[model samples]
Target: MARAPADSHLTPQATQPGGHVPVMLAEVLDALQPADGGIYLDATFGLGGYAKGILDSAACTVWGLDRDPQAIARGQAMTEAEDGRLHLAEGRFGALDRVLEERGVAPVDGIAFDLGVSSPQLDVAERGFSFRFDGPLDMRMGSDGPTAADVVNELAEGDLARIVRDYGEEKKARRVARAITQARGDKPIQRTGELAEIVRGAVGHARGKAKAHEIDPATRTFQAIRIYVNDELGELERGLAAAERALKPGGRLAVVSFHSLEDRAVKQFLRTRSGDVPRASRHSPDPDPADRLPEPTFRVLFRQAKKPRADEAETNPRARSARLRAAERTAAPAWANFEEGRA
Candidate 1:
């Protein structure tokens, strides 16, 4: 890591000497296939984990994006370590096009996105992403904006219920919302455990001392709050579009998403191949066939999703949740929002 410049506002966590356990190394590299002198995009530059691997494996230029200012600080160090081949952009992955524009970047050779929160975001209690640690309900991934507490303590009961039901896919959203409403009457839901306990109590009929779920009972609720707090799904939509615009002809796009919701969004986005309408429904108006078409933008490299080997899964349990998908761009001119169905 390079020495920090003066006037740095980065936290100790950003400067902390820790290596992130990358989720899927072999699959990411195999799919992206970064070539020497190629420009690639790392849409989610958490901890610079994938960036490190890409830099080491290929003589490519990696332009990385992340919402966390802290991540950008760390990435500044990493770029220095890589002799300035890595470009760190302080923004959400959804804004890939704008960031690239400011950097004078044209179409890129490849794009890699690791969807969902990073380990550091969850492990740190003060960040408030996990219920395991009792901290203030502040689940912002960037740690510089509206938090889970604001949602829990401020959203209307109906909206809260919807958040739990839709984002979380939790069945007991009504009861959970009711519990939150009542709890706030006595005292605000100020901490993660307080909210987690309220969720557990609301599901008294389903709670098992053994295990409410293979995961935590509050996992779904927490996920719902975090999703709303960060507008994760919306960012995903914009990121997909931006990536489509960024890829060069025959360029690759690889994404490793951790859950079904994210995987489904990616699955549909890739299936639709961004900037093209879904053939699933032809009722939507289409441009006249008389007009010249831009040509197909991408073709699927693999018909099926890829998973890590058993050996790899054993070594990194996190890889189990990873579902990788890849595609190569064609000559198409990137119209926009291919996965309109997801929106």
Candidate 2:
């Protein structure tokens, strides 16, 4: 079965001295198929894990992109270690084409995106990604933008419910939203612990109850707030498009998504761009030939997404929910009007 983001546990083996283990390194390598003299892009370079792996796997140049300036700064050592083979850029992956163009890098042979919050971001209490640390409720992936506290304290009850429902997939989003609105009336919900308690009180935590089993009550709400604050889903869609534009023919693209929503976006993007759209049912008439879809721009590497083996998940708990999907850029011109349907 496909896993959710309920498992936020980080095992000791998950990170080494300077970097965390790249989830599904071997699998991603196989999908990317890095070759000598080829250039690759790590669109979500958190700690240079995938970048390092790609550089080591072949005599290729790696250009890493990250929205977080801290990530870009931390990766300088890796750039030096590679003796100019590694180049780190500070920006969202959606702007990857521009970043590459500015750096004089041509269309790359492979591009990889490991979506969602990184381990370092989750570990830092100040970033407020996890409730385990009781820090300020700021979940911005980058240094800019509105913080989680702003959303919690300012959004209307209905808006809050929508975010919790749509992004977090929380069933009790109405109750949670109402509780938040009520609580914030007295004072702004500033700290992670305070907001978590509010959510717990709103959504009862009965161990055996339906939708209230093992996961913490605040998990879904936190995820929703974080995703909203970062505009992660929108970023992923644009990143996929940018990858299409930035990849050479036969260039590979691999993405690792932790939740079902992100995985669905990746699946649909590949399906639509690969000309695998479903035909109208027997009861419905076929479309006109003039309205025919464009040719596929990418060839999917696998019919189904791949997951980590049980042993790997057991060793690094964070890998438990990671889902990998890969594809290759085709010779056709990019689809100009690909639609990203609602989640």
What would the per-residue lDDT of candidate 2 be over residues 177-259, giving only the tens digit for each residue? Answer: 99999999998999999999999999988756557226788999999999999999999989999898899999999999999
Worst 10 residues of 1 by lDDT: 1-10
What does candidate 1's lDDT look like per residue over 1-343, in tens digits?
1111122232211223375567666667777776789888888887877676666666788888889877788667778878979888889888898889888986888888888888778888988889889998998878576888889999899999999999999999999999999999898888999999999888654444665226666888998889889999888888888888888888888888877778888877776653355353567677566543345667888878887667656766667778888889888788643345332
Work out how many backbone clashes candidate 2 has.
0
What are the RMSDs of all candidates, in order? 6.9, 5.1
lDDT of each: 0.77, 0.86
Clashes of each: 3, 0
Instruction: Report the Cα lDDT for candidate 2.
Output: 0.86
What's the CA RMSD of model 2 in angstroms? 5.1
**Per-model TM against the reference:** 0.86, 0.91
